[model samples]
Target: MSPQTKSKQRVRDHGEVFTAEREVKAMCDLVKDECDRIDSRFLEPACGNGNFLAEILTRKLATVKKLYKSNPYDYERYAVLAVTSIYGVEILADNAEECRKRLFALWDKEYTAVCKKSANDETREAVRYILSKNILCGNALTLMCVDENQKDTDKPIVFPEWSLLGTKLKRRDFRLDVMLKANDKPKNGQPSLFDVPEEIRKYLSINPVTKEFMAEPICEYPPVHYRKVQENG
Candidate 1:
């Protein structure tokens, strides 16, 4: 690519940026408060440019600094500790890579300043693993298929290529007992489909009635249910 073409190749062409100074500060403040409140892990499903994540790291360092005021040598480990506890997911590979770099940069900045030393190979590897597992390059809207019938649509739906470091989801795991029981009951049951959950009723009442309890488009099978996916994911 020529310099001229590169100049025209813009980041905005890919996706919209959602960062604002006030919003970033508020996110950091929330992380600080939460760290104080429970001292637990955090996750970001769509960490675009690491703005929110960077702020999170900063707040975590500040909180840890105050927590271990007397013994500050551990701040380097604290910075890494904070970052390792954080997870992120980004759709774009380049953006995901960028987010990882920014995260490491922030961690290194704090680590070096506090410890007066550079990150070792071990630390770098840890950061890389964290990026590979947590900052995935996949679509959050992805749905799990129960059978071979379910597949991507004929019309290509471009989604992130990244895979999460978690257990795969399945239909049976959702435990939709009421829905399944309603499905199992014969139409002889007293009331009509209307008595079932709104979702079940809606699925049953599509204009072109489907013979199967669940309908699958010819090309795409095992239709995705967003609510189920989120719960399982």
Candidate 2:
């Protein structure tokens, strides 16, 4: 089992404690169906070394393997999709970095075995890039990116929404603060999208379907091949 505590200072400073593997598995089992769904999104607010996220990725990839193992193309894309759906915000830079590497290792192990000879470097780099963005080094409480010392920075934590379109992927970046408030009901006297007269941000407008504030992307990029997502940078 992975060590639960890295050091007394981290625990005291950041409340850094990794959940045990057994507990992680047990907790994940409670949401077995979601974990097994390839595109279902899971965000870990206090993700440390990714004990829970790792298990969820394992379950999701297992489903991907079972369904697409015969088709390398489908297997590769779905595996990447699975990685995209898992997100994390860890306060400690080293822990966040470790979490990213650990999750990628877990992903690559399964990916290589299933896709075999068809697996390519571009795809591996794409997964690495996805993990780099998905597992952010930030303060979940402050909803801001953290410095090396784990102190909050001015930059708000932004998460990229990755949507697969056939062989391509579309990405939209949204602020964590905005995302958290997106579902809040419009204040009794406040104007919703329909009530606004002047030009307004689409994301700030009420989502007609959900009757909640829309979580608009701060920045959007055109679709790119899943393997070429890094090209957007």
Best by lDDT: 2
The RMSD (Cα, Å) of candidate 2 is 3.2
lDDT by residue for model 2 over 113-162, one digit each (tens)?
Answer: 98899999999999999999999999888899999988899898989999
Stretch of 10 with least lDDT, candidate 2: 194-203
Give the TM-scores of the predictions, in the order they appear. 0.52, 0.92
Local lDDT at 77 for model 1: 45
List candidate 1 stretches off by more than 4 Å.
Answer: 1-15, 30-32, 35-39, 69-73, 117-119, 143-233
Give all candidate RMSDs, comma-separated: 13.0, 3.2
User: How does candidate 2 fare on TM-score?
Assistant: 0.92
Report how far off residue 159 is in candidate 2 (Å). Answer: 0.4
lDDT, candidate 1, 64-149, per-residue tens: 76675445444544544566556665555666788888888877666556555443555555555545545655443442111222
